[model samples]
Target: MTATTLDAVTPAGAAARRPVSGTVHSWDLSTGVDGPGSRFVTFLSGCPLQCLYCQNPDTLRMRNGRRVAADEIVAEAAKYRRFIRAAGGGATISGGEPLLQPVFAGELFHRFKHELGYHTALDTSGYLGARATDALLRDVDLVLLDIKSWDRDTYRKVTGRSLEPTLDFARRLADLGKEVWVRFVLVPGLTDDPANIERVAAFAASLGNVSRVDVLPFHKLGEAKWAALGMDFALRDTPSPTPREVAEAREIFASQGLTAV
Candidate 1:
């Protein structure tokens, strides 16, 4: 988000000088939910933020991830290449902040694009977007960018990081005309605020590159995970968005002329 360093990386740079390894939490073969078509989604490991509502808190630490070479991951994904292609999906590299391991994630994405000849998508918070090399972004066909909140105070409280970085990255993507799908989680008493959503939608509209918006209703499904990790679940009493609430949120995005699903 700070000006990009992506241009500084070369395919034969450090990425190729050694075995670019990424810490992986898991991977899944899923329908077009993450991007277009059926995809081979790799959940890379490590993150800088400690979001209060993380569903996979287990993946928050670098030590918890299994180290792996980028090539090895591509080989594993290659097995399902045909299936993924036939289903119109390709590959998606998600995180625990995929940007945390920029070189590793970039290598995997680069290989998928050059060797596998498949579309690639990156799921990131953009908190570490400055870590991403331009080469990495070029390989990405789409981005599932999560802009958690628009209010500065609320944003800091929600993600424990500055909101400007995400906006900077979003602006950079818009400048590149990259296709984006924005995901917003609806926590009724929190992110579901009308003004907050309106501001988010307005900012997204200004971007002009966003094609889809997903209004995800928050749930307590991660309560058990929090307990297992011995972390207090502050939103335990917060309820999920009602149908009416979700509709209203979606309507806000739609007012911007963007498709809100």
Candidate 2:
């Protein structure tokens, strides 16, 4: 992708423009889905995971997104800073996996906090390298971390990856005292097993920084996206998690003393 140019007058009043850097699939400066507060959401590009139920399948291809400067994103987010502040909310950087583009995510959050005074959150899969972790967490206020599954074999089958790194990332986040909300998609046959739910609850309970757990009921919302891209939908025959399933999963977490939202 071609680098996008971002023009900005320097604080010294000099005429200058710099190339803002980062791969961004798209950005919705304001979205209500991310957290308690209204948010200015930046959907970054690229992800390593290939979850069968991924809703944004198009985001999995790193090359498909546009390259934009971090400054450009900050500019757009700045426009809504007041609205974010008024609503007790802030900016949330989500992605194909925001951690995949550490430089951009870090710079965006840094600018948001230091430059614009907006609260910052990262919605991520936490599959980033150690260096990326250091960068991405620098100014982040909250994290919406997706814990794919508890059982290693089941995790591998669902995401084409192991669960160790994701768990390690969560532990590190907790060590840093970062506020996190652990999100799990309750896939009927995959994630709703009694044993798996209990395991997940135990894992989450061990994390001090995990403030909440969100049991997102799996749906066919992404089937069309998969069809549009001509990729076979892996969970096509699978039905959505029933209300009772969600409640059971919620109870599993609640048993561990963690609120499931």
Query: TM-score of each candidate?
Result: 0.93, 0.90
RMSD of each: 3.7, 4.2
Query: How many clashing pairs does model 1 include?
Result: 3
Q: What lDDT is obtained when candidate 1 is compared to the true structure? A: 0.84
What TM-score does structure 1 among the candidates reach? 0.93
Expressed as tens digits, the lDDT of each residue in 1-261 for candidate 1 is 111332233443454575567678888888857899989999877788777778877777766678777778889999997888788889999978898878778888888888888899999988888877788899899999998889888888878899898999999999999999999888877788899999999999999999999888888888898899788888888888899999999999999898999
| C-alpha positional error of residue 210 in candidate 1 after TM-score superposition, expressed in Å | 0.4
User: Could you tell me which 10 consecutive residues in candidate 2 have the lowest summed lDDT?
Assistant: 5-14
| lDDT tens per residue, model 2, 60-92 | 876779878777888888888778888998888
Candidate 2, pairs of clashing residues: 20-69, 21-69, 29-40
lDDT of 2 at 8: 24
Looking at candidate 1, what is the lDDT of residue 102? 81
Which portions of model 2 miss their true places by more than 4 Å? 2-19, 29-32
Report clashes for each candidate as comma-separated counts.
3, 3
Q: What is the lDDT of residue 217 in candidate 1?
A: 85
